[model samples]
Target chain A: MAIHALIFDVFGTLLDWHGGVAREASRLLAPVRPDIDGGAFARAWRDRYQPAMEPVRRGERAWTDLDTLHAEGLDGVLAQFGVEGLTPEIKRELVLAWHRLDAWPEVPAALTRLRGGFLLAPCSNAHVRLAIAHARRNALPWDAILGAEFARDYKPKPAVYLRAAEALGLPPGEVMMVAAHTSDLVAAAGCGLATAHIARPDENGPGTGEAAPAAPVDVAASDLADLARRLGC
Target chain B: MAIHALIFDVFGTLLDWHGGVAREASRLLAPVRPDIDGGAFARAWRDRYQPAMEPVRRGERAWTDLDTLHAEGLDGVLAQFGVEGLTPEIKRELVLAWHRLDAWPEVPAALTRLRGGFLLAPCSNAHVRLAIAHARRNALPWDAILGAEFARDYKPKPAVYLRAAEALGLPPGEVMMVAAHTSDLVAAAGCGLATAHIARPDENGPGTGEAAPAAPVDVAASDLADLARRLGC
Candidate 1:
């Protein structure tokens, strides 16, 4: 069977998380600290993402969804920046910034076209609720939400990729994992899923590293529109 | 937070599954047997649904998605109706009739309205792929797909209702189960979720059984549009 579904890595692959979060953080926190660099704060918070999930991934802690993880990590980032006296309501709103990220300009149109031919969903590290909220806000048009929470483990885990394919009743080979992150694609490929890498050059920031697949991907494109075209959508 | 999401029972609640399936069956099988009653054939096939899933629900057999169950049950229905010589391709297509079901006339508009206020999804026993197909065909606009496949268990099981709530990151009380079936509402109420009953008087063919709440529900309406109104969407 040909690839029947395409699962995406949401944060950078579908939505511009760094820019969205940074923008929100700046808007919310600028009054508190004039010296705060919102972009750096966003980077700092996201930098903790992998390490925060490591304990759960290694079985050192019980599984926790990404929303809880994001909230917990936010506290440390706030303290690190010496930003304090924020009310619980503000903190809650800030935590939800991840759920309000804007999709890349090409995403909605590309997904709409791709959806006509293949099932589209987010196979992100974000929890289901986060995925749902983000999809609603950004109009991602996912057929389903499958992610770290659904698999009860974070990405780069074989189970996450395998279980997502299983949930779609598709063999791994028939499900393509589309991600801007080379590591996600590599991990998905390891689990027998086909891979597509759509580069998001500004995912990290202007001067940061660009993702190149460590291993060959079935398709590599400049963005989701390019990916959609490459996939013959 | 008062019903953050409304999870629906898809087949009878959202789509006119019986009518749609019957119509498809009549179109596909009338050539072989002029006497074949398509509505009766649809009812007979659906009649086998619960019994087919009992083993899986009871742990007597490993989990099998509704698509496979429908296929297996179709063989018996074909034999029961004295229809034969259908190719594997034809049977496969017939089994997929469940996916191409037409939504009740009010479904799309009501869902679009409700979508503005709440996260909406089909908490059907249908597999994720089936749900995806149905949504694409009918423009159901589900925020996420959750059901038997996600829970690895069928409806009326507390696990199904509870897990759906969990996936939304909401407490059971904040998630409402909307169904045309009283039994599904009762089960959802038992799990501390609110319930809404949208009557599908023709669900089992006219005058067969009008679904009435065996227990008190949060809302009861003549149809999905009525339900949307009662829910203040």
Candidate 2:
């Protein structure tokens, strides 16, 4: 089947969330808690991401958006670092760090090219608000923002991929899931969508992310530009 | 309160749906039903729009997307016209006329100017798929596709406005609802959103649509360009 649209994993695939979060955390914490390590704090907060969504995924909790999850996780991370006396405004600003992430340089130009050929959207765990904020800062040129909130579920779930394709008005076969993570690709593949893995060698941190797919995928490229080229964008 | 975003009423405010639908209906039916009046057919089809949604709007029926609604409406329209023998493909193509509308000439440039300072989205009764299709055809620079499907309800219902504001992650006061219709503007204002009315003198047909607000609006303009100027875009 012809691929008519590409639904993306925003955090790892498009934006440098780990670095952005680390930078924001450091900028905010350095003035108050000199001993706090921003990288460690970012990693610790990220570590709670999937676990936070687990309850919603398992139906153990009602649908909760990522903002709440990040806010809750931030409290735990701040406590884990023994940091104190931060203002509520600071916490709110810190949670918004995910929205202010820098794109992975080549992503925008490649997206400009790809937009000419296919409908593009972010099928991420981030809600529509975060998607708009991310696109505003990065100028990502999205046709729409899809995934989590529409599905009311998170990644690695069939609903996210299925509902995203449905939202794009395409069958799963005509919608390709583009991500840096193999788990997202596998889940999309299981839903009959095509999959592309854009390698992000440092999505987690420098050298911590995959330089190649950890599992089978139909297409794999060094970055979004490479993926665009391979897809003849 | 500052308006951080502008959510549009896609059909009349941004797109020339009546003209586009009339043209499409004429193009298809002129070759078949020689006696059919395209404008009348377009008006008849649009006349069904509100009533079809009444059951869904009143909660007498489950949520139904516009495509399904339009398809059903098309069946009634064809029968009403005493026309028959349209293939399923032609019927499907006819239904997609809603997705292939031409934007009002000044709307895009005005939108481009407005986009620099505020996020833009279509808060139409349109579902995500229809929004994507409309945006693809017009290159309307939407930050996200929002409205009906998200609210599981149609316009004039407070849920649609309230949920769209929630999805944009802003209070209703910070999001301006822009429409050519007083009903939509009134509904949105009741939900605490700021409202702007753009006069579309020919939205329904020549001299048929509103040349000015029939009800009070926060701002009223000759067209989208005038609206942009008043908004300091």
Candidate 3:
């Protein structure tokens, strides 16, 4: 079947979740602790995101939502960073910051080009609201949004990708999964969706140095803009 | 709480499933059965879409996907039309026709505007794959793609809306639901998401005359572009 849709992994593929979180955390903590290693703190918090989903991903937990998981992970990051004197309102505000994260500069135009030829959606571990909010905030054009929430398991898991295909009403072969993380494409590949890898510098943590992402992908691009061109968008 | 996301009802809201199907049918039948009321066939076929979901929506069935329901409904419309000599391939083609339906001319622009402000996803009764495929074909920008698959239930049921919000990590009130259909918004309203209504002239049947949509939405606009403006997009 002709490729009809492109399912994207939002965090590193379209939006700069790592950079946005790093910046947002830097700003949020700056008022209290100027010495806070904003970059390190951001990475630390994000490092926990995948592991945090492990319990649910592994089926050890009865499917916790990302919001609650995010809160759990954030609480630990705060304590480890030795940040103090935060009110509940402030903490809640910080947690909601995930909703306002910025998109990479190339995303808007790239999305426009990609949409000309394919169905674009975020297939990610991000909470539905976070993904949707980010898309709205950043202007990532997607046809639908797919999340781990749909499968109750995070990406890199076959269920999530398969569920996404099921939702799109297309067989796995016709839909391609795009992500900056190779591990995500690997999972999507397992479910028969063609995979595209768009490398996001921030996601792999600076110079983990473009060591190939953990998953196997079909086409690798430098970013969304390149991915669009490769797909003939 | 800050509104983190928005979920929409697909059919009449995003794609003019009704109108598009009517137009396509007109083109197909106009050539062979010049005397056939292609418009009426279109309207009747479109009308069956929701009623077709009634079984799954009401818990009378075991949560079959929308494609199956559409097939069943398609068979009924075919029978009623007394259209003869339909092959299995033709039937399959006809049933899948819903997947290729066109969006209202206003959709792409309005969606562009709405996408500028909020996280947008669909909380529709359409199967996930169908929704995803439609978005790709139509070039909709959704952050997350949600469907009845999550809760194993259809819209009008609180579970569908609630599950979508929960997936997005937003409280029900923090998420908004947009649709051209009244009952869909009503259900979303019941779930506490802000609701917006778009007028779909072909929904009730061609020339049935567009009246005000059935319910009071937060804002009723000429179409999505108007909707985007009203939402501060």
Chain A only: list TM-scores of all candidates.
0.96, 0.98, 0.92
- How much is the lDDT of residue A186 in candidate 3? 72
- Candidate 1 per-residue lDDT over residues B74-164, each given as its tens digit: 9999999989899898898789888879998999999999998898888999988889888888888788888887888898888899989
Order by DockQ, highest first: 2, 1, 3
Q: DockQ scores for all the models shown?
A: 0.82, 0.83, 0.59
Candidate order by lDDT, decreasing, is: 2, 1, 3
- Alpha-carbon local distance difference test for all models: 0.87, 0.90, 0.75
Q: Model 3's CAPRI class?
A: medium
Error of 2 at B186 (Å): 1.4
Q: Write the per-residue lDDT of candidate 3 for residues B14-98, one digit (tens) a residue.
A: 7777666666666665545666675688777767777777877677888888678777887788788877776677667666777
Q: Candidate 3's error at A138, in angstroms?
A: 3.0
Write model 2 residue lDDT over B48-124, tens digit each, in one string.
99999999989999989999999999999999999989999899989988888999999888999999878888899
Better of 2 and 3 by DockQ: 2
Best by TM-score: 2
Tens-digit per-residue lDDT, A54-106, candidate 3: 88778888877666777888889999999888777767767777777787788
The sequence of per-residue lDDT tens digits that candidate 2 reaches over residues A59-131 is: 8887789899999999999999998889999999899888789998998899999998998999999999999
